[model samples]
Target chain A: MKNNLIKMAIFIKTERRVFFALVFLFLVFLINQGLYTKNKITSQDCMDGKCSALVPEKPQLSRENSFYYIDDLFKNRPSGYYRLTFQEKSNETEKIILKLNTYSEKESFVGELTVNPSGNFQNQEIFFFLPEGFDSLLFAKENSDSDGNIFIKEAGISKLNIESEKELVLLKKTVIGDTKTDLIRESQLSADYIYPWLKESKTILGQIFRSSDEYISAVSFNIDINKNLNPGSRQYVLSLRKVKYDRENASFDGQIIADLAFSAASIEKYRQNDGTFLFPIYGMLEKNAHYLLSLDNSKVSVDKQNYLEFKGSKNNDSYGGGSAIIKKEKNIYIIDGDLYFKIYGAEFHQENGVKILNGAKIEDSGKGMGKYSYAAKGKFIDLLDLEISSPGMGFSEDSKVITAEANDSASFNYTVNTIYPIGKMNFSATQLKAGWKKVSVKYSFNQENWFDMPFSEGIESRIDSIDNMDNSENSDNDSSVDNATDISAETTAQEMIQVFDFDIIPTMKEIKTVYFKITYNPNDESKAHSFALKNLQITADLKMK
Target chain B: MLKKILEILIFAITLAMGFYFQWEIANFVFFILFIFLILHPIPSRFAAGSAIIFLLATAFLTVFKQNDLAETVAIWAYYLMIFTAMLSFGELRKEEEKDII
Candidate 1:
């Protein structure tokens, strides 16, 4: 019975010891887990391609460490206009030139921009067209021997859509005349003059033509300066005038419709009869009205060795619409051939265009820039580009949260330039916690005029009412370290979902680029307060074509 | 002497393999430890000493890498406690048997 008791006592002691060891192991496991959580790394919070979109080089770039460029995974990029934006600062003012070069053995240059960076960091943007074969992009200091250091970061290139087309109109080109040398006929009236008399207002070359188009943007004249051996430049004035051809009083005069001055220096010297000179005539001309296109070198007595003239097909009536005529000191000489000319102006045409954004009809450029369209369907796009100005405010690495440290009056800005015109945007700010005194939302198109966004529906006014009540309650209390924190209904807050609905003005919508700014001002309490915007969303209103 | 040396060689190599690979090496340690339980079980006198040596090695490697130290030590401590308890119970049973004899 005593041996049984002893054995039972030994077994009980062993059981107690095992139980204590388990408890100790459990405590150690808990400690290890806590440490593991503190040291967790979120892969520096970068998603695939997004890290490539905007790169801040880990090392400081300087003259010695000069070259910084991005390939942008060129395989996915299409031939389109791309705008490169970067933040740069220099110890001293310096110029960094960005050049887009080709990838071939021959160093063919494409485009370039010289940026002047000051001591303070500044964001600069330049738009350039990307063509095939010109894939290399490099930024370098103008001087290789500079002592100062320049840092460039957040250098990103985004594809942009050009809404304006300049080279779309060229339908009014007359047949090229080469049979005759129907010149401006610059010759001395007596040959006693040093410079030719026709170089003066004595000789006026005119072509009377009518157009069905309402606007005339520019006029082209085909002439070879290969014949003119003049070393100095000569000024030629092109004038368009309303004509009343009575066949009686022949004069190159009327109320001047439009006139363009051309210098001999701009025309390629000693070149064949080719398309070179373009006279800029920007004005609205009456459709089907007879207007005279005259070229005169009355700016100076024409150079004896260098005078302006145009090529023509002699004895051949090439242009049935207009004939080449020259007036020499009141004599209107008619030539059988017409001078080769072309007129370019705006035209109207009906065509298909992009109608929606990010929809199935668009090709993915990998830049998130969807179909370029005017009438875009409504979409709730998550704003990713965040710029925080306060020292105590920043994006939590995954960019899911805009974290606000204590007393952080943070201005979070997101810039968006969409192809579609924004009519109304729906913004929802989910405030996780609140010690914020006031939260105001404003937006600007030009960054100069900021208008307060009015809420269409949400709990913003309720928050304001709560804030006012809290303010009244705390108005009489003295702020002391020993004084207990007066937790009003405002301080006793759960999550607040404030939705901001604002209709953009028509003028601002025309601007296309909108800078959305939200500022949250936290209360100046000594406690380390933290709050976050769980998410902010933007819903672009759909437009009906 | 050769038998003792062979037993230690098997034990050391299996444990080191267990530490290197989490799954395969763990099975190897299990196989060798079971074999040793039949062939050359750890005496209670050396159980505390062996556990301490294992803990020092765990600490040294943890500090050298500074990665997942807490988890590694926790695992080592749990297994060491189990092995020590088994050894102590075996010693207790042998002592009881000798007392009966």
Candidate 2:
């Protein structure tokens, strides 16, 4: 009985010792956990500075008589033609034959061009050419109701020098219809520098001008600037007269207005050190104009400053239907609306800036999460403002980014490294609390959190290659289970391959926005967030002796 | 005789509880202690004879059945009896040496 008592005593002693040691170990663990919790810091606990961000400006379009280009190779412009008659007075024949050269042998004749009895001529082609030194060859008919001019040269004439030793002046003249007299009268400045029959035959006001450098030159309705005006500041009132077609009752189905008022709002300027400037002003004008008004000339000239031009084939009385749009493979564009929101701007920024940017707006659209809550180091980020503030409790580490996992009711925060200013920020979590349910991001600046949208981050791609099985037949009955698995598979492999054809699938549809909390690291100046030190200002003036 | 029986009873109870608790190592230890106490009450020669039987049984059961409840109990009994027999053999050896001297 005594030994039994002794044994029981020893057992109790050992048990008590073990229990105390376990309790001590547990207490030590708890103490360490408490210390860590106390030291935890959050975004709000850190200092504050400017919450700086860059909001992209919305893209716009404009149009003018400016040069826009598709590639570096193609050059385009618009030109117009007026009455140009060739003549030579014949002394013997008593009759004159009028002749003009068609420049191209393989002429794609647009339409029938003719000089009417009224002497009003029409040229369908906007572009025309002449051989060298054909200047001063255009002349007006001398007699009314008479073909008084004869051709010194035939049509399709080769290069000819018609230069005179005495300077010859080309005069710009206007022809008017005289309905009362039922006869068209022609007048010109005679060799004596005066109109001989001005009092006898009513003379239209005419002006003589020097010929330009190019004999084959284009004459179109253009703004005649007395003084050069800055492209952006220049504005004009343009009025287009209704077109009169020669073919009566014919379909005047084209809708191209000859004149347009324009301003350069998006000119990309490049300033040289010497103060000279070169930029793609025409491309800017065309893009912005067509984007806004849908009337950019399909053909645009991208050469020379202050010499921008646009040309388009008339269709539906406008530039449309099979018109080539400015296609850029990839470029960046600034996007902004009434309110500058990060996700809002990013949603509209596209890989190819020329293509349209389309995405859903979570704000006011009622399509996305309306609210979010986050807690990091006892600090919370306000969902509406996305600003962080301390909860007056635990602390967070400096220079670390607080990753917030937001749900309908609860949000958890984890700290991560800083992300780039322009790229994506991705976050993931595997372990979760009970009744965790599903988690979707309210904002993820990075593509790591993909949103499934067809038009935004999706493209149509066809399957290029596929795996197939041969139809040739062979079988082995004496085989193990693993070998039979391969053998029987061969029996149906050909049919399976034929059935399982490849189809295109969307890889990622949409990207979520990632919100980052700034970290304040005291040890590193460069690595620290800009707002790590909230400036305290005190201004005063004093005089010292 | 009553004391001896009581001693055996207490040892058996200890072994039973220990095995129930899955305390296999503790049971063997207590079984050896019980053997030492039992040999103190028996004639030295008889104790030696019983020790061989106890050791054989213990080796057989513990090695074969391992942690089986029934077999574990058998091992406990075998160890306890073998420990008592070894104590008795020590005394016998002492007696023989004394006689030879």
Candidate 3:
């Protein structure tokens, strides 16, 4: 009994030691868990002066001829989050304000100011937040606007100011270079000049003047003094008149006249062109003018000519017309006349010093009225947007389809464009029996050889395998067992979507083309299987070279 | 002593088989071995203690490694521990009844 007591005591002592050890382990585990929870919040180190700014290279396409512009200052000008990083100087507690000026078709005047802190060259992120609900107002009209133009005169961080209780002073400001502004204005001018005539009809007006035997058409133009001209010439107003097209009447029934005047110094430079200078005359007419407007006589002396003449072609009526001009070789007609013109004034303050007087007149000759028509054989249709569907056809015929009776099969061949990496093939089918059908997919770079597609293990075949088996062999089987199997198989077979993902390391040297075969051999020959494939969309990953 | 040795040998074999094949056959064999162990006469304290040790050791080895067999082994060990505990409780009750008589 004494020996038994000793053994019992030793066991109890060991158990107490183990209990203390377990308590220690549990405490350690709890401490570790607490540490992990505390460390879960991620914090970025911000000591370097260099920081990332959200500078969008391309404008986001918001709609047709409308875009969302993003920059450091105009980050929230578009309805999207623009995340930018700024270096805060260490130990500096001054409040910094980022200022922005924005212009759009809806509103010409929009401004925003955001307060930030300077933390002594520490990298910090500032988010300019604009939600999706405000996207409509944020989207500015692109240069392709049909009406008057709205262009970005200035963008980006216009000013960064430090604020104190006493006053606010500018710390840094973005200066837009003259060359950069010129480039922007040049692109905007191209869009304004070309886009209108490229599309359908819009009302364009000019002036025509008839003084005795001479007829002159004058149209006002805002010529960029900084571009395509001599250095000394600040501004010039040109007066000229030429033939104009009347699209509705299918003839040249009107004359355009422009009376141009320049600052006295610019006038001397304008005459130095040696009577061979050509200026573009832009006009708009009604749709369906039957005649092509061109200069009739090329031999007209440029020195003697004071008015340009445009002749109309003898073609049939069409639906659209563009800006017209009358020219003799490269020389345009210039006439002395009274000027009345519309001036598209420069908006930016930098170009405020430039000045000019411009005028134009238009006169209808009433000789261009006529009726015309043309006939064609067949209609040209665009198939890209056409959605083709057939009723009672289980699926739409947007893709290829193949129908096979019992013991029959069909194959489809597709040529890949090879521009992107082939990712996988997704195939879905209806009316497939679970145990009775077996479908296999294979791919090959070259059509001569084929290999089975890499599929996950235990994935059942889509085609019915029982259709290929002999029907006479299972004559004695109990119907109840068959019925139970059929019910379970039917439930499993109802999942018709199957994805054959490509292998991690594809073995094909080059994927040029692929062929898919669908073999349907029904166990019962009486039933015909109809498979209408909606699409065999090739999923590809774009590879950059 | 012979029964205990046989039970241990069978458990080791099933554990290895479960790791190798990861099939239903190993699970079936383990189930049968558990039933045999439950039916054989053994002390309740010894049975409960040994079952707990075995379960803990198996779980500790496979806790970090995840796959088909690891999952199956973990599940089988849990079920075996539960059944062994129940059997051990029954044996303890029988022992108490005998003492009372």
lDDT of 3 by residue, B1-101 (tens): 74456446555544654444232455556554554554354555655575576667666655443222344455666766666676677678778989999
Task: List, residue by residue over A1-545, the lDDT tens digit for candidate 2.
Answer: 99999986785564443333334334534543343222211112221311111232221111221111112111121122222222122222222212221223121221222333222221111112332322222212323244322222111111111233121122112111111111111111111111111111111111111111111011111111111132222222121112222212111122321222232321111122222111110000111121111212111111112222222222221221112122122221111111100000011112222211111111110111121111121111111122232211111111112222121122322221111111222222211111112222232335255332111111111121112111111111111111111112223322211111111122333322233332222332221111110111111111100
Better of 2 and 3 by lDDT: 3
Give the least accurate 10-residue stretch of model 3 chain A, judged by summed lDDT. Answer: A356-365
Candidate 2 ranges with C-alpha deviation above 4 Å: A1-545, B1-33, B36-101
**Predicted candidate 3: what Cα RMSD to the true structure?**
37.6
Ranking by lDDT: 1, 3, 2
DockQ class, candidate 2: incorrect
Better of 1 and 2 by TM-score: 1
Scored against the native two-chain complex, candidate 3 gets a DockQ of 0.01
After TM-score superposition, the amount by which residue A540's alpha carbon in candidate 2 deviates from its true location, in angstroms, is: 37
Chain A TM-score of prediction number 2: 0.13
Candidate 1's C-alpha runs over 4 A off are: A1-201, A224-234, A245-254, A269-280, A328-336, A348-421, A424-504, A507-545, B1-101
Chain A: TM-score in each model: 0.32, 0.13, 0.22
In model 1, the clashing pairs are: A180-A313, A180-A314
RMSD of 1: 37.0
